[model samples]
Target: MTSAFSLKRTLNLARWNAVLLTRNRLAFVYAVVLPVLPILIMLAGERGDPAVGATSITTVFLVVGLFPVYYNVLSQFVSRRDELVLKRMRTGETRDAEMIVSIALPGIVSALVISAVVVPLSQLFEQPLPVNPVLYAAAAVLAVIMFTAFAYWTAAWTRSAEAAQLTSMPIILLASLGPLGASLADSNETLARIIDATPGAAMNELVRVGWFGFDGAEATEKTLSFAETWSAAGPPLIVMAAWTIAACSLASRSMRWEPRS
Candidate 1:
């Protein structure tokens, strides 16, 4: 009985949040546009190089998975807090976890949908299909979870909806560097090690391994066999898992249900 009620409330909250999201014209535009922008940019410069194709596919997937969580979920959380919506919701039957999940569902769903489209369409665009679908799926799921938790973490500091953009920039930059994980590994081993520990780099490394079997190292000239070994998949999975735990912990501790007065 309680479980059923919770599910109903969660679904209703998600639906309401989705409607609010679609009503925001600018955010709606971003939801529609940002997922495709990297693909278009990559496709435009695609020269049939397998290495480039692999990198492009990794970049597109990471961007699709991370950007929406940063831009949409974080902003919505801040906006709701500033407007006292979260405070009001808390006074009702909605639990904190449900509220967080409901608010994040729309952006997370958008990111997942884009990722689903990007993966297959990537092959059509002449990129290799994901050689390890399980690894790719795990990485993408972790990306969404980590980013959503980080969104809440950022919202703890963001003063208003206007501040969300600025607060989110640091994580955005960190995740944005993920696409360059391969090149960075080749050029500067120390820097590559540092970046690989981050969630963004984890996303790209997982994709690299899944698509090109190359674990974010210097791209080889020849096509490689699909390598889904524990050796290839373990490190990034650990990194993402650790980050997800830390982010969720911090967000739960620091999150403010009411506007800062």
Candidate 2:
């Protein structure tokens, strides 16, 4: 019955947010449809290419999982604040963490569902299963956590719900570009090093390692054992952890509870 962390209240808020999000056609399209576009395109492009590997499919899954969470969560937070929903909630029994989590729950759940679906679909397409399930789970969890923190950071500067798209673009562009840049890493070392440090690229890299048992930079058929997965996971994990800390720290400092206007 802890008021600060009431499970019942949190679940109620989450359910309400999920219902609201599903009703917004625009939000639903961006959260659910937009992310799927890239995967379809990839499936078409790689249709007969025997060179298409599990790494490529894993990258698609990463995109489907992370981008929607970032965009939808940012929009939700800003829209609620602009409507004074966040302000009203502040006067209620909801705690800060609960408020944020509730607002983010719909998008988070959508991302998770998409991530889960990606696995089975990949299997259907003949892509190899993840070599280390633990690493895959860890990467997925960390990706969501890191992006959620960055979403809050972006929301702090967003003045209105309509402006959320524009304000969230920088992070979105950075994250989107990172994976694309990583895809071309074999041809470019400098870009590889830089993109590998980015949150999105790091997440994708971890997924590649977890599923393929080899980092994207080193394409090998050798399966990574338990200790090897952790070893390969280290650098990307560090990079993601750094981004998470920086984003959360900055967001905690500047986030506003009331409408900025």
Candidate 3:
């Protein structure tokens, strides 16, 4: 027989998910508008820049497109996870894993929708197709998962749902400016070495390389060398994994079913 707590938690998640999503119009805009706006801006700028061809423009577009979808949406998810509703649901039948997944599902769906809109629209506007679709696709999926997990980890430190907006700002800001960070790091060996040690920088580098089709054995060798030297992506992925594990452990240990004191 189904446990009473699980049933109640599931019901609570379904109810709160709908209510919060419907009530928060700003959340809706952030999901839909923020990612798409950069694409529009890129299209507009492409008309004037003779030097900026389809490939470069598409690269910029992809990087910009990901900011709102992954960063903003995930931030919002983390923030919302701390609500009284969530606190109450934890008291019910739902497992901690179930609660987190249910909370994230809506935002994940929205991110996927934005991604769908981005690809075709980019092509329709004559932006070149991504050079390495497989690599890009992998990077995007990895990014979403990593960021989502990171959001939860961040939420653990946050005091309340209201604080999510402020607490999440640093991540959103970093993600929004990731491309710039990547470029700057690329030029400065020392800075690049430092940024390469950052959490999301490897994903950024991989995506940029994949999107731009920096291929051949030489490129692969260089990427692998960079991977070994800076150990950017590998270390971050491991850190994210550890963070996810730790977050789960913490949630299991500290999570309260009833409202916070």
lDDT of each: 0.76, 0.76, 0.52
Ranking by TM-score: 1, 2, 3
RMSD, model 1, all Cα superposed?
A: 2.3
Please give each candidate's TM-score: 0.90, 0.89, 0.68
Ranking by lDDT: 1, 2, 3
lDDT, candidate 3, at 92 = 57
Model 1 lDDT per residue over 126-179, tens place? 766667777767777788898898889889888999988788888888777776
Check candidate 2 and list the clashing pairs. Answer: none
Q: Which ranges of candidate 3 are over 4 A from the true structure? A: 1-19, 47-83, 215-260
- Over the stretch 167-233, how does candidate 3's per-residue lDDT look in tens digits? 7676655454444554575467787666654445555555445544433211321232323323333
Which residue pairs in candidate 1 collide? none
lDDT of 2: 0.76
Worst 10-residue lDDT window, candidate 2: 46-55
